[model samples]
Target: MSHSAIRRVPASVQSLRSRAVWLLLALVLAVAADAPSAASQAQAPATADDLKQVQQMIDKGHTDEALKRLDELAVTQPVVPGVHRLQGQAYYAANRFSDADSAFAAALVQDPHDLESTQMRGLTLFRMGKPAEAIPLLTAAHNWGPQTRVDPSYVLALCYLDTRRYDDARHSFALQYGFPPDSASSYLLAARMLFRRDFVPVAKDFAEKALALDPQLPLVHQLLGEIALAGNHLDEAIAEFEKERARNPLDGAVYDRLGDAYSRAGNYQPALESLQRAVLLEPYNSAPYILLGKVLLRQQVPANAAMYLEHAVGMDPGNYMAHSLLGQAYRSLGRTSDASRETQTAEKLQADTEPKLQNVK
Candidate 1:
């Protein structure tokens, strides 16, 4: 990060909190003597030794053994919050998100204010594809430590990013570090926000930084490709998107970027191929279909274009671009009545939106 970049305390504090959680857990074990057993030998209370052993196993990359210890510890200390907390952390490290969620929930019920447990629970929820549930928990965890820290805020920012709350993500990221985010996440979100505001140079710079940090980052590649496309750097955009596809074969947006780049480069055949792949990857998303239609329309394949546009409208009735392009395709095919209807629909859809086309023609 550049020295001139804006730095804020909240984001820094959040990062510090995340580091402190691990350190505190270690200190908690070292300084705090093990409590006496709360059960018989068959079901003994978990001592600091149990937690330390689990931690050691985890450090050694023996997640299964650590989790097994957590299971035994749980049997003896079912009501002890740390038992569930350890299980949660173990499951999370293993990428067993659903199991981690259940473990975290059990821990939260016993120790509601346990910052580490709460943060882990939030991350587990995020990994479970429940960003909405993760956001508030992460926000609360961020407040557990001093405001000058950064880790908690970083977590909160990521939750916002996952939920597509770009403005909130930007604000959270801005709190700790300025313009270019220190992490790949902060850079990606900042780039998008800057792009949305038409700050092209600044956005491109951050996007490049994001890719430099984590070349496989999805949004970073997408945005960088977009900026390159805007500058008529079609080959550059294709290269960026190709790198993204290599990293994430299932990413629909990468194909969409490829399609856009190919189309602008006047490679209609390749454009169609890429957009078709995008739609195949994300059949429910209407944007790729609309773009596909536009490409076919440019090729003078009105019938094929109309079919895709109709599909796009079916997927997203409110999509003005789809409606407008469908109208154009209908007009090109001499389907006057259909053209008029689609044009009217498009007009209505555009009534409250800008960059408005008065007619499809």
Candidate 2:
């Protein structure tokens, strides 16, 4: 998926708490401990035997036991350079984020230039919903050198994305992927990053380069479709989405985009079919439901529109567009009180978001 597609929190749903939830989920999937092995701890001036033992326990997947041993060592050797670092690794492996964060912090105090501790601490802070604190540590780790294993650059890119540092995120992701500019994947990734930053013209240039390099690249057509949609070139968007569908028929996001394009092009029947397919493919996503409601309303099927809009609102109550559309549907169905309530809610949401929208530029 494109970074723009993933990171584009709906304007109506732009709350830090909500964005943090999504970011934390991404961090959990991406971040890993940059733990050094026993033989690789040459620079550490700590008790080598204890470090070696901790690494053995971690390697054997006995994280709990490793934590217990680290705790024992900490009571006697609290200022040991690598001790807390190893403890952080064990705690991270055990999914104890708070403990891991503190351990990493302690390790950094003892040895400020410890790259593994720095990266692990940054990753821990990110997982703990502290992206601002993670940024400097991650940047330092990234600047240190190439990571042999468990690169922290991806997590760092995500931190930049979460913090709305678009240019930094783009650079970090490019570094993480390490693809030459001529590579199709590199072009596509650059396109997605630029798209997220609202640099649509530049994004289109990169997308075109990706297409020129490999027309059959998995998401290149989808990126083009998104660009076309952004420009309100409905027919062009539909054509690109159709090409994507031909290549990846089972992708729910493609169906959702195609359905949206069809609806905008006044092809209601096809829009309904495409959206229904999207719902079947990814039932949890609310976009298809919202689009289905919209198409139904356009088709003068207010009753059906109300049903789908209700589902959309149920799934994502913060979606102001869905609320507004549902209000229209309810008014058409002669549900005056319900329509009034939904309309008022939508208006309030729009008013609340107006300031943020104005500040976007």
Candidate 3:
């Protein structure tokens, strides 16, 4: 709980962070990118260091201080290159979207080739819910020189999706990820992306479209089932997962998801069967092992549950769910000391991973 504690992230959470940061670095950290170099280019020698310090301030969450320093810089050179961009960043970090948009616009006006300014202007507009107004700038800046740290095409696709430009959205998304825009796989990719972004209803439509184009497309039914499962439509999820099973019998993931759906529906026997199949098919993953342990625990077979859980914990030591379930199994078996240790480990793992998981925002 201490602020200065040495933080450690679980491997699972690290994977999530890497995925989220790609999208996030574009939307948030893009403004803060390469500040030292940007400052070194075209400025009074004194102002160069000043800009660096101000950017450091902004990066440290001291936006107010950064803005005040930028104000002093403005007084020295009202037209100083990169000053407005820094101001825009400070405003952005401070949640002053309108001010950020104006500052980035001023930076663009001063130097039309300021790719950072152009990209930030578009992003600020998007943050302000002006997706339509953001398209042109985002489109132009997505491929600008001194290329952005992450593709701006990600947001451009979202903007297109928001404005009901499905074709454009799909095209931009495919371009960002190198998928063929007209293929069934493209729509499937869009649906997966949209599903993760919480555009679930729209995601379902795309998934359906993918199926329409190619009924036997791999994972399309699985994606549909995943959407239904997320929406808590258990029967629908089971139906879709069954359809997926019919199409791709060798996919261990389908069995894993089907087992999860069955477990959630309290059909423990089938859940056990499906999870056991998943365990055989996906030997490298610990998910089915953990789920199998839970099903055993639910059936009051603590000894068996403990065996599976121990295997799961060994496979993924940082998995708090596995640790917590192992604690339950130990408690049921009256291994008081062992139960207490696992409970403590589960708590520690959960606490350690919470902050990293929050980084998804």
Candidate 4:
């Protein structure tokens, strides 16, 4: 395929199909926060134009500029909770945790009964690695949320995960997953969480349930494959992923996962082929490239590995795994300078995104 050629495939069609399957399984998918919260203060009774302007700024990722306008509005109209709420949302989207918490607090100060702001504040604290502090806030929100058009259960589940309350997390998943079990993304999260908590038996059981509900789910087989691999059943895992590929021939994500399974089985040649296909299908995504590069490097194909590794770094500048793999590729190719640079970049990009140690199957 030509590099510039545009594939006719929709970006997330398989994912969409998976959602349909989830409905059949009685799993509910939570859909909230298409956009972050924003404060609603405007000096002059809040015109539509001001809202449009703020939205435009947000779309452009000009958060600071948007906040400046919101700040001006708040000074003259401190009574509006919407302004403070939106400000908190904007800060959260920018990953400014402290600023988001303060904005939400200010909104709550204006109206103690603002459930939206309270839930958002709890979420901000959770994201900031302070789930212990978030527990009470989220509990309060959950208790009063339905009355105020909020689902406290969503926040509650995350809080439970942070506090290592496995039973609570399981209950939360049972409730929400019942709403949307077949959804690939939802099941993936449940499987990951369950596996992290060392609930191996349940994780496998849930993976099987999710697969039965949605055979073509993008990531469902992958989780099953991982579970099997962890149990030393490499051939079973590979066969499972192969079955998934047969069910959805055009799914690049499935191919990448199958490739991982093949690698674990020590089938380097097939692993290289599957991962290469995945890279071709989703060139803009860094994961397949990284995996393909690893497979090639394992086979001692240094030049081929370097090309894929370079592409991975180009696609995701902040992906530490990509940089680390690229560094290894460079070293294999005897490029000392490139290797050193890549290693440095990987180190600089390393930050904790994974919440905690949970034994994901």
Report clashes for each candidate as comma-separated counts.
Answer: 16, 0, 0, 27
lDDT of 3 by residue, 43-142 (tens): 4433577788988898899998888878767754556788899999999888899999989988988899899889888888988999999999999988
Across 227-256, the per-residue lDDT of candidate 1 in tens digits comes to: 888888889999877877887788888898
* Candidate 2 vs candidate 3, TM-score winner: 3
Off by over 4 Å in 2: 1-140, 143-172, 178-182, 356-361
Each model's TM-score?
A: 0.49, 0.56, 0.69, 0.54
Which portions of model 4 miss their true places by more than 4 Å? Answer: 1-112, 120-153, 163-189, 192-202, 212-218, 229-233, 317-361
Whole-model alpha-carbon lDDT for candidate 2 = 0.85
State residue 114's C-alpha deviation in candidate 2, in Å: 7.0
State the RMSD for candidate 2.
25.2
Using lDDT as the measure, which candidate wins?
Answer: 3
Compare the candidates by TM-score and give the number of the best one: 3
lDDT of 2 by residue, 274-302 (tens): 99999999999999999999999998999
